[model samples]
Target: MSKPRKGILIILSFFAIYVIWGSTYLMNKIVVTEVAPFLLAAIRFLSAGTLIMVIAKILKFSLKITKAQFINCVIAGFLFLFYGNGIFVWALKYVDSGFAALIVATQPLFVIILMRILQGKKIQSKSLMGVGLGLVGMYLLISQDTLVLSEESSIGIAVIFSCVLGISFASIFVSRANLPSHFFVTTGYQMLTAGTLLLIGSLVLDETWTSPLEWSGKAQLAMILLIVFGSIVAFTAFNFLLKEVSTEKVATSAYVNPVIALLLGWYVLNETISVQSLIAGAVLLTGVYFINSKKKIVIFSRFKKN
Candidate 1:
C-alpha cells in the first residue's frame, strides 16, 4: 500500500477503535438488559462473523487456513471475545456501563505490564508514571460508596478487571500470532469460533434465548449496531492495529472509550456520572497518555501472514 493510503487506514482504524468502540458500552448495556449475556454475545458475533465471511468471499479473499492458524484463531477468539467480552457483558448486569468503561480503562496498564513480564521489555519512565496514575484512578473508581455498598457491584468490578487482563494478554498475543493475512478473514473466523463457544455456554447455563423478532425495537437496533459497527468495523480495526502498530499504541483506545461511554451513558441512559468518576477518568486517561506518548503510528512493512 502507498504511504498516504496506509496513513489513512491507520487514522480510520484508530477512529473505529477509539470512538466506535466507546459507543459499544452503551449498546451492550442496552442489549444485555433483555438478553442473557452469553446469548447476546453469541448472536452478535455469529451474525457479524457470517456477514464478514460473506463479504470476504464476495471480494475474493481466501478463507482457507492451516490447522495451526485455525487453532491460534480459536485461542484468540476465546481470550478476546468469549471470556473478555462475554464475561464483561455479564458484569453489565450488575455494573453501570459508564462505570464499567472507567474500570476497564486500566487496560493500557495491563498491556504494558504483560509486555514487561512476557517480553522482558523495559518500562519507560513515562510508562511507570502512567502505571502509578492508573492505579490511583482505579482505586478512586472502585472505592466509591456505590460499589462498596453492593456485593454484586464488587463482583462485577472484579470480573471486569479479569476481562481487561485477558484482553490485554490477547492484544500481545495477536501481535505475534500467525493467522489469515486478510483482517476480515481472521476476524470472521475468530468471531465464529467465539460465537460457537458462547452459544454452548448459554445453553449450558440454561439462559433463556429470545428470538430477534420478539425483541423490542430499541433492542433490535442496538443489536444491529453491535453486530455491524461494534463487532465488524471496530473489531476489524482492532485486529488490524495490533499488527500495524505497537500494542501500547493500540491500547490507547482505552483513553478515549471511557470518556465516550460516560457521555453517552449520562445523556442517553441517564446513568449517573459521579464527580469522583470524572476525576478518576481524568487521572486514568492522563496515565494512558503518559504510557503511550512515546509510541508512534509506525506501520509494519509486511503484515504477518500464515
Candidate 2:
C-alpha cells in the first residue's frame, strides 16, 4: 500500500475503534434493558463471528488452526468475550453506561499490576504514579455524595472491575500466545467459541430468552449496531491497528472512548454526569497517558483486507 492510502486507512481504523467502540456502551445499555444480558451478548457475538468467518472464507484466507491454537483461542475467548464483555453487559442492568465506561478506562492501570504479578515485570516510576492517580480517581468517582450506591449498583461496579481484569489478562495473553496469523480467523474463532459458551451460560442461568420480534424497535436497532459496528467493525479495526501501528498509539482509544461514552450517555439517555465524575475522569485519563507515555508500538507486516 502507498503511504497516502495507508495513512487514510489508519485514520479510518482509529475512528472505528474510538468513536464506534465508544458508542457501544450506550447501545448495549439500551439493548440490555429488554434483552437478557448474557443472551444479548451471545446473539451479538454469534452473529458477528459467523459473518466474519464467511467474509474470511470469501477473501480466500485459510481458516485452519492447530490444536494448540484452537485451545488458546478458547481460553482467549473465555477471558475476552464471555467473562470480560458478557459480564460487563450484565452490569449495565445496574450501572449507567457512562459510569461503567469511566471505570473500564482504568484498564491500563490494571494491566500494569497484572503484568507485574504474572510476568514479574518491574513497575516504572511513571507507571507507579499513574497507578496512584488511578486509585485516587477511582475513589472519587465511586464515592460521590450525589450518587446512591445501592447494593445492586455496588455489585455492578465490582463486576465491571473484574471484567477489566479479565480483559487486561487477555491482552497480555494474546500478545504472547500462538494463534492464527490472520486477524480475521483468530477473531472469528474467539467470538464463535465465546458466543457458544455465553449461550450455554444463559440457558443454565434460566434467563428468559426473548425473541427480537418481541423487542422494542430501539432495542432491536441497538442490538444490530452492537453486532455489526461494535463487534465486527470496531474489533477488526483494533486488530488491524495492532498489526499496523504502535500499540501505544492504539491505546489512545482508552482516553477517547470514555469521553465519547459519557457525552453520548448524557445527551441520549439523560444519564447524569456528576462534577466528581468529570474530575475523576480527567485524573484517570491523565494517569493513562502517563502509563502509556514511554511505550513503543510493535508493528507487523501490513495485510490486505481483500
Candidate 3:
C-alpha cells in the first residue's frame, strides 16, 4: 500500500477503535444490571470469535498454526482476555463504568513497569515522570469517592488493577510469541480460547442466571452493541491498526478511550463528573503523552538511521 493510503487506513482504524471501545463502558453499565457480567462477556466474545473464525475459513485463510504459536495464543488469551477483560466486566457490577475506565487507563504505566522488569529495559526519564503523574491522577480520582473502601468495591478495584497488570504482562509475551501468519486467525484463536475460559469460569462462579427478559429494551440493545461494535468491530480495527501503524500510535487509544467513556457516562448514563475527575483526566492524558513521546522518539531515531 502507498504511504498516504496506509496512513488513512491507520487513521480510520484508530478512530474505530477509540469510538467503539469508549462506548463499551456505557454498554457495560447498561448490561451489567440485566446480564451477568462474566457471562455476558463470555457470550459476546464466543459469538464474535466463532463468526470471525468462520469468515476466515470461508475466505480460505489458513488456520494451520505451529504448536508453539497455539500455545502462545492460549497463554495470551488466558492473560489478556480471560483475566484482563474478565475482571473488567466483573468490576462493572460494583463500580461505575466511567470510574472503571479511569482505572484501566493506568494500563500504560503498568506496561512500562512490566517491560522494565521483564525485559530489563531502561525506563526513560520522561516515562518515570509519567508514572509519577499517573499515580497522582489516580489518587485524585479515587480520593473524592468513599474513602472507607469496603470489601466489595475494594476487591473489585483490586481485580481490575490485576487485569491491567495481566494485560501488560500478556502484551510482553505477545511481542515475543510466534503468531499465525494471518492476523484474523491469530485473533480468532485467542478470542475463542479466552471466551471459553470465561464461560467455564462464569458457570462455576455465578449462580442461576435470573435476569428477567422483560427488563428495559434499551439495556438489551446496549448489550447487543457491546457484542457487535465493541467486541467484534473495535477489536478487528485494533488488530488492523497494530499491523499498519507504530505500536505507540496504536496505544493512543488508551487516552482516547477514557475521554469517550467519561463523556458518554455523563451524557448517556447521567453519571456525575467532578472537577477533580477533570483534573485527573488532564494529568492522565499528560502522562500518556509523555509515555508515547518517548516511544515516538525511539521510532524516529530508528527511521533516521534507516
The per-prediction CA RMSD against the true structure, in angstroms, equals 3.5, 4.8, 3.8
Q: Give Cα distance to truth, residue 222, candidate 3, Å.
A: 1.4
Clashes of each: 0, 1, 0
lDDT of 3 by residue, 1-306 (tens): 798987797667777877889888778777777777678778778888898899899999999988999998899788877888886776766665546656776776676666567655565677667666766766676567654434577777888888877776665566556789776787788889989998898999864464537658987788778767886778777666555543434555666676678778888868899998899778867865775573544431211110
Tens-digit per-residue lDDT, 186-242, candidate 2: 889989999999999999989999999999999999999999999998887876676
Find the candidate with the highest TM-score and give its number.
1
lDDT of 1 at 189: 98
The models' CA-based lDDT, in order, is 0.84, 0.78, 0.72
| Model 1: per-residue Cα lDDT at residue 10 | 86
User: By TM-score, how accurate is candidate 1?
Assistant: 0.86
List ranges where model 3 is wrong by over 4 Å: 91-103, 152-158, 210-216, 240-255, 294-296, 299-306
Clashing residue pairs found in predicted model 1: none
Residue 137 displacement in candidate 3 (angstroms): 3.8
After superposition, candidate 1 runs with Cα above 4 Å error: 91-103, 135-145, 149-160, 270-282, 295-306
What clash count does candidate 2 reach? Answer: 1
Q: How close is every model to the real structure, measured as TM-score?
A: 0.86, 0.79, 0.81
- Model 3 is weakest, by summed lDDT over 10 consecutive residues, at 297-306
